[model samples]
Target: MSLTKFIEEKEVRNLIDNYVDKPKFDLCAEIKANPQTKSYALVGTAFDYLMRFHFEYKYSIIDNCHWVAHNSLVYLLIDNFKLGIEPVKPIAFLTEMNFKDIYNDSILDVKDLQEKLKEKNDYKGRQIFKVINLILNAEKEYSNFLKSGNLTDGVIKATIDLAKIDVIYRRKHYPNDLGEYKEGNIQDLKQLYKIIPDFSKKKDSNILLNPTFDKASQLVGGADCDIIIDETLLDIKTTKSLRFTRKYFRQLIGYAILADISVNIKKPKNLGIYYSRFAKQFVFNSDIVYETDEYEILKDEFKKKANKIYG
Candidate 1:
């Protein structure tokens, strides 16, 4: 399919309707003629999603904003945290800090604390705390402003806090000339929370949010699927624009393939990309994706790449 054809919303929706029912064939479990091929290979899907990684490590056409991944992890952590899963180890660090009196003299200063943490060699803990602190500050400021009926000071303070944290974190982590992109991501994270409501609310039995799927049965790999509602699989992306790149679409398709092989559901009925920044959503035509030769090649490449990397 041409790039322009893929972007047609109406045509895409029509093709997606085919996934609403149980698939006529087990696309995920279908073994190829070759003996080496396996059902729904995840390494292949990952290679397809991140084709640049195949060429060279630390390379991608997609914007590699450091904060984006951190924000994504935090969002995922928040989802699972609300599901009554005890936050443990690495994730526990995010919620283990207290921000009540961290600020001195109304100046949210953490420089000295940051230095202390560094001296103690608790780098990961410190980094996790900074991200969580920003989130906590945002929530507190937003809620308190709503309660007090004073809209101006509270919201502005929250926005400033977010920007300040982003600048500080990026200086250490990114250390490049992508200042505008980093700043944009901070704003995106803030808007993402407001756009998607009911963060703490649980859904129906069929709808599993942020559940880790173990593909150990297939012996390929395992990963977390963002949201699986009935027969549909959806992944969230918090970006400034609504454009869906080929790699992004392929990533979701790979997850659907994994879901087909591993998850209890027979086959995913539909696939969606939720752009959290503007609350925009794009549904791809999964039926076309499953049967295409391109997907087959992607799977083959993934298997080859996985063997190369693992060996």
Candidate 2:
């Protein structure tokens, strides 16, 4: 399919609808290299609705600021810090910290910081996006003001928004709480998942591959992780049990194998599916964790059996 067609396809809905997910794995899975959705409201029927609506011919595309990836931004920050731009905003609590504090953190004297950075041998004076941090600080300030009272924009009140924040950090605890805990947590994990060791490799054989498993039959593409690489396909899912569902693990196993076949890297020896289960933390004993290699086999065995279903 053409790239545009793939983006607009309604069949994509089948992914979240059919796949299962419920529990969450706390480990920082690597980027393929490691990383880590479904809902059934009427929104689930959106694909059906869109098919019948004859919308206007596309005009200008929506203004989505597809800036650099978060990791890239972070890398730039680190580099800028070395250069003295120090774009890395200190870990300031938003709901707790005020505008004055943020301003101080950003820069007490911009000219002085700039001059010092200019003379430093840190980066040969490359331009940096020092402004983004300022914008984030501003966003945090606005978010904090909004949370000061139940009122929103002085016109509308957002029970849902408040509810989401309250769940993450109660009203008393949430400051500039733009769900930073979750985002910061993801950032903090980048180091923990520095390496993904212990996985096998496989080569692709077009002549030997079952024709039915061609690209046309491949339903999932980049649904998880920043980028899908060989030997590691990270998908986020929520499941009641974290145990192996090897009996019906063919599709995912195929993902690992397919990623291996297509990429030069090691066969994704691991398929990490992350899910969030609401079970109490006290019930830790009930949690199930399966090995990546074990799931790989479960997938191969299931594929052998499910081939009959397709036939």
Candidate 3:
């Protein structure tokens, strides 16, 4: 179970019920989606990638290298070959000839990818292509496309395509199990570009993207949160609804507990949800969740429950 799954347990819900008071906050102005927006999940995931790209472009922060999807997908491809599972469609094509051998030899770790991205002056259009090449083990296939500098539409499409890999990786599904490829709506990118500037204005803030809680994450199988700016832990949501429900509140609280127990560089002083579609963040101080003295008690309870379930 992950942090999300752990929090959803009946016992965990009851624990939250006894502790967390309902948060009261005003909703932000909503930005209506285009009529052509069909894939909400795709857009959400792609926008996440876009936001990371925006951060890297603007602040020169290289932090998403530890993304589980990329690392997990790499492991799955190698494991499938070892098990002699009959690879299908895209996987078969990707692994045909000596590609599997090439993949095993050239698999890049998080550090390697981070260093490579750091060396590039421009990571905006090329990030998704590098990820795709890494996943498919077909650097040659996308080499020309990466060189042509015609990356606008291609980048958006690649972002959505790469987002699809997350589902497969999370479910441990075969690569060929990926559904039909969806074309990315340019309007999604347009919306993202417009709202991103407001969010990125925190120029001097310390930013950590897709941060894990070290051994705390391992306690509940795995958990990696969105961006944490300075002392605030924020989860990016691209949903149209502005409702800050109990579940959402509990998620932020769960992340706080994880951060508290872990040896992370920064501990969150506040927790927030950045509704990307609305381009507004609803932030609440950690004190709002629990009193200073109460937090230690809560953390101990959380660890006990997590150990009971995950151990």
Candidate 4:
């Protein structure tokens, strides 16, 4: 079980119900979505990727290159090679070409791709969209040259062909949802970029991208939080709904307790939900949300529950 699944367990829900309190915040004016927009999940994922890209371009931070698609590809490869299950045509073609070895080797090449992207010195929406696709495609098409003993020209041709198929495959199965991949999603990201505050201006702020709660994450199988600016942990939400639900509140509280127990950076002083559509953040001071005594008690209870459930 992952932290997400663990938190949804009945016992954990009961703990949250008993301890967590919803914070009050004024809602921002809504930025309506395009009528033709299909999948909010894709939009959310893309927006999250774009925000990470934006931060890298705007601030001084090392690229983490923590693409969630890598995990999806790993599982797909395992199913194909280990379990004797056939995947979609594009994926099947990849597996047939001994792409598993390429996939293993390409993990190290993400930094090279990041360097190439940095050389372009362009982080605009179109460039970002293309680069994001390239990264998601695993950046292993070049390995076809060595595998097939093909010349540069043949390798370039094969790479383009493979890339096209890969994009088609991803649009069908990425996030395991049905939706058309549209240019409007990129446009939405551009609009979101306009609203992002310049974190570089903040005094003595430290930014950790895709921060994980070390041992706490290990205990629950795996868990990663979004950007943490200074002492604030922010979860980006691309949902159309404006209401701050109890579900969201509990997720933040869960993360806070995990952070406290994990041997990572200092626990967040505040928890925030950044609603991307409205470009608004609803923040709650950690102290106000959980009093000192109550927070310690809850944290201890959480650790015991996590060990019993996932340890």
Cα RMSDs, all models? 16.4, 20.2, 9.1, 11.6
Summing lDDT over every window of 10 consecutive residues in candidate 3, give the lowest-scoring window: 83-92
TM-score of 2: 0.23
Instruction: Evaluate model 1: give its TM-score.
Output: 0.40
- Model 3 C-alpha RMSD vs. true structure (Å) is 9.1
For candidate 3, the lDDT comes to 0.64
lDDT (C-alpha) at residue 146 in model 4: 32
TM-scores for all predictions: 0.40, 0.23, 0.75, 0.67
- Runs of candidate 2 with Cα error greater than 4 angstroms are 1-8, 11-234, 237-258, 269-272, 276-311
**Compared with the true structure, what per-residue lDDT tens digits does model 2 show for residues 1-311?**
22112323343223212333323334432123122212221111211111111010111111111111222323333444532223344222222221211334544243454454466535323322333333344344334543452222211111112222322211122223332223332322222222222122323211111112234233332211212223234332223344434322323434444443343323444454432231111111111213333444543443443343333
When 2 and 4 are scored with lDDT, the better candidate is 4
Report the candidate with higher TM-score, 1 versus 2.
1
Candidate 4 similarity to native, TM-score: 0.67
| TM-score winner | 3
Q: How do the residues 1-311 of candidate 3 rate in per-residue lDDT, one tens digit apiece? A: 68888888988887876777767877757575442477787678767766665565556444543444454445443553331222222231233312223434454443444454456536331333344454453223233344553336555655665566776566664344232454445667656657664555566657787888888888888888888777888898888788898788888888887887789645688899988777788888887655755667777888899889866
Which candidate ranks first by lDDT, i.e. highest? 3
List candidate 4 stretches off by more than 4 Å: 32-36, 62-65, 82-180
Q: Is candidate 1 or candidate 2 better by lDDT?
A: 1
Q: Could you give candidate 4's per-residue lDDT for residues 199-268 as a string of tens digits?
A: 5585445788777787777777667777888788899888777778877888888888878778965789
